[model samples]
Target: MREIAVVFVLLAFLAHSAMGEEMVFFADDLYKAAATPELHASLVDPAVAPGGSTALKIVVANSGRVLALLPTGIQGSSLEASREMQEELRSVDALNVVATLTAKDPVSVLSGPATIPLLPSGTAQPVEFLVQVGEGAEGPYHLDLRLDYEHQIDVRISAGQASPLYVPANVSEEITIHAGGSRESFRADYARSELWPGENGTLTLVIRNLAGPAGNCSARLLAAPPFRASDQPVSLGYMQPGDLALATFWVEVGDNASVRQYQMACQVLQDGESSAWSSTIPLTVAVEEGQSIQIWLVPLPLILALAFLAWRWWQG
Candidate 1:
């Protein structure tokens, strides 16, 4: 009887030792590396501009150990041997996986904390984070992620003889982020505040390049109600950073235009690319009503009579 009891204890000890081994395998292709610490993450991209969102793929693996003992000669049964100690694995409860994001200097965290329900030895899970950058944020930025979870591991050595072990997992990863630099926008103003009807005038605009990498700039004027631009689209060539270029547009006021101010719109494009629209500005031009036609006609007949008399004298 003593020998049999010792034998049973030895078998239980061997089984416990075999079940304690666990290996975690992460997909290398899916891992994103950060610039600072040489660690692996789910995502680290520089293409994220101001007010953008990015997703991270967080996966947990148990190394294909989901089964119990199988025939030795059968292929792919070695991992199944661990299942002998975990027959109640399928009946175990689920776990809550929580993730949070934090951005370093120059980068602001808009919104984040994507959570999911994960199971042991299950498929990969994904989390997302939203961030925004400041206009003056000319920086090399990065993000830090914190992952926390509560998992309940099940171990069953025999029928109706199972024990539950609760474990908490926490991990941290860093990701890189980026944003665009500031640039000076184009602005336009009228040369004169007011003009008479049927009068031709010029409008002046200043294109400022201030720290932006834009070239081949051009602008088009859009007018409405009694205002017409002689040059619809004016071309203003390249301007280097900290340099300003002057643009002028010839415009005319309609003869019958009202004496009120009319609003005009201007659209700018860069690099001679029609598909891209740089900026839109508003301009105001005022037209004053002209004198009555009768006032001007009073001298027209006198001038004609003088001309006729001159022609009669020549004939004489």
Candidate 2:
């Protein structure tokens, strides 16, 4: 009988401890329902670039409060497709007024020596910024968002952190175009490589003039095969000499597309005339896994000639 009583007492104490512990969860601030949409865009704009830079535009709206001690200067969550997608959101201080946006105290809201009072309910007045969409990012990315919050329950007897990520359905599509080249030089030679289906990588465009001659140039990427049939065409803008251009794109298998022997090419432009285009970079996009595609291959004739010459010299 005493053992039963002891067990009951232990369970009661544990239950009470758990109940009083605070659990932080995210809920859309009912008052600012309209702001939620804006917030979503702001949060994502900095990190989104798809189907060339021409398709990029910044979007912002304040959604409901994402409950938690939202960590600052961290990529909350994003889909990873573009070669490099970067986004930043911060409220260093309020614009109209001055105050520290990420102040230590929940009640403290000051932007640059300007103090902004809290909302009527003592809610943390948040100032968020979703600034500047990245340029020329291709393909789609669903950034991983920290959808949940952290809290302590059971009268602070225990604490835990939670990351809530919603399952993603294809929300947006992206297509990026870039020239193949050595990271050191966006020269014409390095840009010639066949891209296969299921192959994805960054295209770096380095536009340089004749060194002495001053001129304007444009770098363009045309979609072919698997990349061509995507929803719509992605256009790369005209790049000037010293134009630092980049785009990330992906290649998915198409109905008729082969993992072997696909075609894509690169074209360069100066003034208005196009440079002698690079060789057609041939590729073999695979499906069921037969062989790794190599966009760059040695010419058969060159290989045979070299082998013959080596044999003759060895005999001598």
TM-scores of the models, in the given order? 0.35, 0.23
Give the 10-residue window scoring lowest on summed lDDT in candidate 2: 29-38
> Residue-wise lDDT of candidate 1 within 131-202, one digit each (tens)?
767654433366777767654433323233434344666667655443442123644432333345578777
Model 2: per-residue lDDT, tens digit, 49-121?
2222211221211222212111111222223211111110111111122221121211121222222232211
- lDDT (Cα) of model 2: 0.29
Q: Which candidate gets the maximum TM-score versus the true structure? A: 1
Which residue ranges in model 1 land beyond 4 Å of their true spot?
Answer: 1-40, 44-46, 51-94, 119-122, 152-154, 157-163, 181-316
- Runs in model 2 deviating more than 4 A are 1-187, 191-214, 229-253, 272-279, 288-316
Pairs of residues at least 3 apart in sequence or in different chains that clash in candidate 1: 67-80, 67-83, 68-80, 68-84
Candidate 2 to truth, TM = 0.23
Candidate 1, position 5, lDDT: 29
